[model samples]
Target: MNAALPFRDLSPDAPRVRVTLDGAPLDLPDGANLAAALLAAGVGSFRATPVSGAPRGPFCMMGACFDCLIEVDGVTRQACMMQVGAGLTLSRPMGKVAE
Candidate 1:
């Protein structure tokens, strides 16, 4: 594990919640960082740069960077600053997605 990664130890029986991404259901532990959870779930990209159309994910786990932008509950938000919640719906920003 990388020392700089925002890794948190979870108990074997950590409670989980169900959230939807791009209409697909995902199970994530409660209170888990949304961006980290998505990445751990194999989501490689979050959004693309508006100009160059480059795919981007989380650059900083904190709220300092806007790379991890996504739609949550009908609004664009920074995934890294949000916690996984039950019934939350998230979608990638509409635009060019990395191939």
Candidate 2:
């Protein structure tokens, strides 16, 4: 676990797998909550608001809040509701520009 991050992995010895975040490679604990893993790995912001472009990350952490929205395998998904898996390609969803 990285001490610099705000969150810590409870299972420090858990198995790790490779995943890509915004094209950057990251080795995260397999089967862990995607949001929690990203947070533990020092990911500060998950996405930007479509309207304001303000940064946002996990909030409710229970699939209620859409703050953790991210693009995974070409689909927009809530990071908090998904698990860390090998070969996952994650990226911040593109926000619509104000007209």
Candidate 3:
């Protein structure tokens, strides 16, 4: 994660970013990373490892790793790499990775 690039923290007056998670609408901060947005929505697991089937979430927010995979707009993608956009539908994968 690039801790140097400051991100605006959630506040009462902050404008809402409309997005969908698991078919439900979620209001998050504008320009938030997908991991942070999903975490705010109480989503625990974003993906599983291909070899171990281990659950993953936001690990290295800088996109160096694929630990934050999630389905967005019907395409599986790296959550950490995506900026929170309006009308995004996020979901977890159902298939398990090979061990």
Clashes of each: 0, 0, 0
**Every candidate's lDDT:** 0.81, 0.88, 0.73
Question: Could you give candidate 2's per-residue lDDT for residues 25-56 as a string of tens digits?
Answer: 99999999999999988887888887887888
TM-score of each: 0.79, 0.89, 0.72
User: In model 1, which residue pairs have backbone atoms overlapping below 3 Å?
Assistant: none
Candidate 3 off by > 4 Å: 1-12, 50-53, 95-99
The sequence of per-residue lDDT tens digits that candidate 3 reaches over residues 1-99 is: 233433435654657778777777778767777787666556667876666677777778888888888899999898888888777887777456654
TM-score of 3: 0.72
Best by lDDT: 2
For model 3 the local lDDT of residue 70 reads 89
- Shift of residue 15 alpha carbon in model 1, Å: 1.7
Model 3, residue 90: distance off in Å is: 0.9
How well does candidate 2 match the true structure in TM-score terms?
A: 0.89
Candidate 2: what lDDT?
0.88
